[model samples]
Target: MSDDTDDAQPPRRLNSLEDRNAVVESALDRAIKRGDFDDLPGRGKPLTGLHGSSDPDWWIKQKLDSEGINGVAPAAFQLRKENAVLEDTVDAFTEESDVRDYLAGFNARVREAVMDLREGPPVFTPPRDVEKEVAAWRRRRNAMKNDSVTEAEPGDPEAEPGYQPVDPESVGSPRRWWHRFRR
Candidate 1:
């Protein structure tokens, strides 16, 4: 006697600004690594919506040709820009004593309201390329365990050059099933 229409799933939760922040960081990282700051001030101009900002290179050249400081021009500009972004991020987070007192603050009340707002949504099974992911993982694990490609004998001059030792940092990862998980 149950209707399937009553089992519809809820819409996904997402924040567009968070996605934009990630993209900006990615592009900024590539630009910084390549020393592509020729577009310095402009690197984040449109991205920051900072008006046709002063050119970073221009400021550097001016400072160098006049003041002889190797790091001041661009560094100073960046300091100002970072200061603004920090101010904006702070402004976005409202002052809330709400979470300070368990039964008092807005944070607790908001959380309660949200829980009430959500009548448990219907669950939906998502079709995923689990087989492909499994194959990829197997290929990776096999590669990690099969790194010896040389026929050289141990400690011989013919021994293969030092192994590019695997980092302990990269040796184990949470994604691997070998990592202990709480049942």
Candidate 2:
């Protein structure tokens, strides 16, 4: 109708792309609003002037990511399993029960034993195998002494009790003295 003539055909429906994006935005907003969250104290509040930031999910995700600096939960499960294994390993022979029952019984017994100790007296006894204990200690001491291959220099601060020491002067080259001041 006018000289403009519509050769551009009114810029092909960009509404479809915008509408799709808006639908996605609405879904994300709903999901984020529905989630439970704890407020962080002292963290900066969102500024009104900022652009490109979406609502809700960005804040939720930021909070979640910050919280992960404390290590994940499953890693602690290893200690529980190892503790269970150690109970049997440390006592090779004892009265036995199914693993679940044993854990339950041990927990109850340990609780009662702690209460009993608090109340006092299971009558402490001296070791019956003092000679065996002494011999075992001697073997450990001898094994440590035998296994040590290097001798440490007396009064050397860098040397460990069982290890060899190096002279700091030996590690430097007498020739390197000139080179130290260059570049």
Candidate 3:
């Protein structure tokens, strides 16, 4: 009975590797003829976000940028970026106390990153010296004040034409809240 059943069953034909390749090739050829891949965006242009570096995590960075996500970078990268702009940032503050506080907070974050055990890139950003930065900010502020004073000095030949020096007392006093309705 087993022999009769085997004889009755037809042999199943297994596809060879070449047969599979040929099927895929023919499908691709048909797709090409139909212009399925025509006019794709960035088809001929060199890829962006390479930035000439072979960083291993390039794909992840590309994904984040494509999604318009920000502030998700590793601590090391954020610290380095902040370090680069630290001087300009410190110079913007009007008060010495604010500058000191900003520097303290920045340094604290840097220190935290440096000591962090769970890692991505190593933190290479050095903490700013609060006193040194404050001194620099003070110098910048004084220099700006001197320049303004020199430029707006009354009766000075170097002063700009049609320039008027404002009366300090008049502008320095703030109008009360009711002053606006008085007008």
Ranked candidates, highest lDDT first: 3, 2, 1
User: Candidate 2: worst 10 consecutive residues by lDDT?
Assistant: 122-131
What local lDDT does model 3 show for residue 40? 94
Model 2 misplaced stretches (Cα beyond 4 Å): 1-15, 33-143, 146-183
What global local distance difference test value does model 1 have? 0.48
- How would you encode candidate 1's per-residue C-alpha lDDT over 1-183 as one tens digit per residue? 468867985754547989778878988999989988776565654543245767767656765768766534333343334434532333333333221232133233334434453433321222224344344445654564576553567776645576565568877645767555746
Better of 1 and 2 by lDDT: 2
Question: Between which residue pairs do clashes occur in model 2?
Answer: none
C-alpha TM-score for every candidate: 0.16, 0.20, 0.46
Cα lDDT of all candidates, in order? Answer: 0.48, 0.51, 0.86
Residue runs of model 1 more than 4 Å from their true location after superposition = 1-128, 148-151, 156-183
Clash pairs for candidate 1: 98-105, 98-106
Residue-by-residue lDDT tens digits, candidate 3, 24-136: 89889999999998999989999767578988988888898899988777999999999998888888888888999999999999999999969779998899988888888
* 9 Cα displacement, candidate 3 (Å): 51
Measured on C-alpha atoms, candidate 3 has an lDDT of: 0.86
Best by lDDT: 3
TM-score winner between 1 and 2, please give it: 2
